[model samples]
Target: MGVIMEMNFNEDDKYLLAKKKVEKIKGFYGNLTSFILVNIILIFINLYTSPNHLWFYWPLMWWGFGVVIHGLKVFEVFPSFGKDWEEKKIKELMEKEKNNKNKWQ
Candidate 1:
């Protein structure tokens, strides 16, 4: 037979978790805003300085990829690193700690 355990979060834990989530969202927005503003300036510079040979697309494409990944991670759009994965990892760590404590006792 296997023993089952349940984890519960108190009010403080809930509040902290919510705060962390909000911070991640804010950070993502900040990153996205920077990406847009910087790319706009790059586009302008490329056009004004060297319109004949364009090169702004290079940074735009690479930075856009990073922004997309940041957004996906913040929004939990990727299943591998989403909420389920976090919870599972937390539980696994807690179980490991419990076993170690038991062995010492």
Candidate 2:
């Protein structure tokens, strides 16, 4: 009885952890998509305006930095909320789940 009860508790914990990680990845990807769209619109608007008004180009350089950051996040080269961190969390959750299954058996 004691062993079975412990196994159930562990499995529940693993499920909850996995759920949280999935939610986090969803939110991160949503943000990333939105950021890309906004960057595109801003660039188009800037290029459409007059050539004498050179104020927007400076912000474009900053925008390029943001693009680089987002690219890194997308590629999983950096620890992003969607990619690296989520992968690590999922691995940990799976290991926990596997251990719980072993205990049940």
Candidate 3:
């Protein structure tokens, strides 16, 4: 089995956490830009090449869904679920497991 490394986070780690969020937002914007450009080109091509069928909406709908999810993840809407939430959940589960082990013993 591979060794598992435990994460030890400190208050100073907030900066690193913020940096990661910034990176995520940056990536989301890049993806959004690409989505717009590619979809626009696809729309034009679909309009000119196969105007009867109009197949561009297929990729547009799917890719637009992805962009919306990416936006939610980057902006942390609805269910944010940040680092603090993760740490709290970890501690809660660890305590619960410890208690269960003690009860069994």
Candidate 4:
């Protein structure tokens, strides 16, 4: 036989979780917009100022790496630290705390 567990959450809790997810998506979009706009400006400046030197790519590449990681995290593409990991960690910690309290009592 297999064991099944149900997790119940109230309406407010569901709403708050949904709102937090939306906020994360919104933040990712904001980061992407800033990355595009700033990189555009940097490219223009590099082209106009140095032309042959081409140093704009330095910041673009590094900042782009950060943006990519941020997108991956926000979209939950990386499972290591995603929703399941968070819930599991939370439960684990709660269980540990309960055990400690019981030991003390």
Number of backbone collisions per candidate, in order?
0, 0, 0, 0
Query: How do the predictions measure up, each by TM-score?
Result: 0.87, 0.45, 0.74, 0.92
**Cα miss at 62, model 2 (Å)?**
5.0
Candidate 1 residue lDDT tens string, 1-49: 1233566889999899899999999999999999999999999999999
What lDDT is obtained when candidate 4 is compared to the true structure? 0.89
Off by over 4 Å in 2: 1-9, 51-105
Q: How many angstroms is residue 16 displaced in model 2 relative to the true structure, after the best TM-score fit?
A: 1.1
Q: What is the C-alpha lDDT of each candidate?
A: 0.89, 0.64, 0.83, 0.89
Candidate with the greatest TM-score versus the true structure: 4
Off by over 4 Å in 1: 1-4
Please, what's the RMSD in Å of model 4? 3.0
Q: Provide the lowest-lDDT 10-residue window in model 1.
A: 1-10
By TM-score, rank the candidates, best first: 4, 1, 3, 2
Alpha-carbon runs more than 4 Å astray in model 3: 1-11, 80-84, 97-105
Which regions of candidate 4 fall more than 4 Å away from where they truly are? 1-6
With candidate 4 superimposed using the best TM-score fit, by how many Å does residue 11's alpha carbon deviate from the native? Answer: 1.2
lDDT of 2 by residue, 1-105 (tens): 122222333888889977876675676677667766776777677767855565565655676677667566654565567544665676677777878899999
Q: On a 0 to 100 scale, what is the lDDT of residue 24 in model 1? A: 98
lDDT of 3 at 74: 76
> Between the candidate structures 2 and 3, which one is better when assessed by lDDT?
3
